[model samples]
Target: MCECKALPIRFDYTPKGKVEALGGDLEGYVVAGTKPAAIIMLYDIFGYTEYPQIKQVCDHLSAATGFTVAIPDVFRGKPWSMAKSPAKPEDNLIGWIQSVGSYAKVSSDLKLTVDFLRARGAERFGIAGTCWGASIALTACSQPDGVFEACAGLHPSLFGKDKEFAEALLRPVALVSARGDPLETVQEVVNGKPDLAPKCIWKRMDDVEHGFCAARGDYKNEVVTQRVAEAVQLLAGFFTSNVA
Candidate 1:
């Protein structure tokens, strides 16, 4: 089985983006883009309020790529309670996951956000996510009705369903795998990108653990900060290359 381990909650940083209404059910933190190309920044189980670092990353990507970066509050303020680390069926983390259950459920929420974006004149699109959000980002792109031009999944926890993620790729993708995440599995995901497979890349950050590029990232650590900076460049460059 694929491994998933949640780290301690972090509260060291602040984000510059502003939270605002996009339309019906389109509330999120955003950095406006001039290219009219936008990226949906998906969050981990921790949600945005408790882990502001998610928005910081979104800001970094927005700064680096000059694209509109936004992460909607899909949880509606009720995210994983962090009652359990590894997650048990009885815990709030699993409960939240079950509530969101599959990407289809989350996709319905995303459709609202996408509709808001479309109404705002957004023409190009990209997506990036961490952990559970990472899994959904990949899963979303695999769907026949997927609208993203490219996708980036940082530290995806596929839970033994790596093949499904690989086979679901319909566009260019970049996966930053956490240390100890199966290399072959992530490689298969990039390789499964059909005619666009050549543009897909799997970057393994052996120095960091899962969620290093998202909520769990320790910006205080110089090493993690450096790695996250590299990830910023990688993801920003990838999105700008295709979407911008």
Candidate 2:
């Protein structure tokens, strides 16, 4: 029984393609709490439109920790349909990956988000993502003096043999992965890296695949769903300890 509840949110459309940044209107949700903390979340390749499950995650996190969660639409203003998306899921993910603002284009997206929440009377900040969004979460925190005081990821996709991205990640972060996931190889590469942030935390679950958090039967497992809920709880705790 999750006490998670969803609050109405406003979308502030940002055109990043022209600005060359993490553009698009941000999707915001507030959960009932006293003195809410603020957090930003990124979605996976399936895009935010495909699954309503992520809203549950946001609501759950907010209910557990009193955080004002904001999820950004990074799909270039394009919605995705499970049955009608043009590119394969992986390709769609990669496209968004390549779309993240360059180092020079970091702009005010993150900072503006922090300011927005603070303006709404929030006091703490955090970030989290899943699958493709997981990597972005890590990178966002890696920025010097990142607005997010705490961050987490489940089944992150940062398992490349190279440390290029990992090295840039300089903030404390948590990673949750499934042992049976096809992307487990990438998880291994990330966990095995020697230069991971001193605050990087890693957890691996067995009998789960890449998109276990997704509601789709193809990737969802009851046990794994339980595991993901647990992971979300852990992330809320981290945000509590570090952010608020």
Candidate 3:
């Protein structure tokens, strides 16, 4: 896995429009490359980090696709420890705030992020999110075509919340999951939708659990990684096919 610190590109953008209330500067690292193939990666419930696994996603995806990637910090300067859910109720709220912000906040930030990328030569843009971020990616894709042309949701945790929401998407999507995961069934909704343009759905490695990206640890699945890389390729292909 490569280091997140290794990438040298950076961008600071002020979120505009209705998202201004959730207003905060969006920060992301640009892996410098040519010809404007950009991917905006959404993080898990854990948020963006300097973590090896997170960095590996960016590094491998860039190496495989030759696309400039930028992963934004959505926690607005919070640390990653907030996801630690304790048995006590008081501890839970602190943990929740530390980890997941309000859904509106996340959606707004993402809208701003996509807009910013589009302004900065990201014509072939796609969204990829893991776990909680996968749900966020779904919401962002539901918006009437502006920012993201495609979305890839991995081990998504919130795909079945509202059927109407799933019905609203007008883009291409790819969903990856495992059988033991709680959200495995959720991927079905995204898959079943005929309204979505280009689609790929999989729940391979049936025995794997939630947080497969991290839980699997150093023993990464080359096949699954290749699948993800292929999804990015398809997503970039979708953008080229549709937007270009």
Best candidate, TM-score: 1
At residue 100, candidate 2 shows an lDDT of: 64
Cα error, residue 82 of model 2, in Å, equals 3.1
* Model 1: per-residue Cα lDDT over 33-147, one tens digit each: 5567789978988888876877877877777776778888887777775656667766655556867746767787677777777766788888888888877787777778778
Off by over 4 Å in 2: 1-25, 76-81, 84-96, 100-108, 159-162, 180-200, 215-221
Query: Against the hidden true structure, what lDDT does model 1 obtain?
Result: 0.75
Give the Å error, residue 234, model 2: 1.4
How does model 3 fare in lDDT? 0.54
Rank ordering of all candidates by TM-score, starting from the highest: 1, 2, 3
User: How do all models score by TM-score?
Assistant: 0.88, 0.71, 0.68
lDDT, candidate 2, 1-244, per-residue tens: 2233322221222211111122346433333345557777766656545465665666667766766676655454464445643457665644544666332333345665567667768777778877656766777867796677766777766646225555555556677776643234433545665654344556787666666664341324457557656767767666776677
Give per-candidate clash totals: 0, 3, 0
lDDT of each: 0.75, 0.58, 0.54
lDDT (C-alpha) at residue 149 in model 3:
67
**Model 1 worst lDDT window (10 residues):** 1-10
Model 3 lDDT tens row, 108-149: 666676666666666677677776677667667777855676
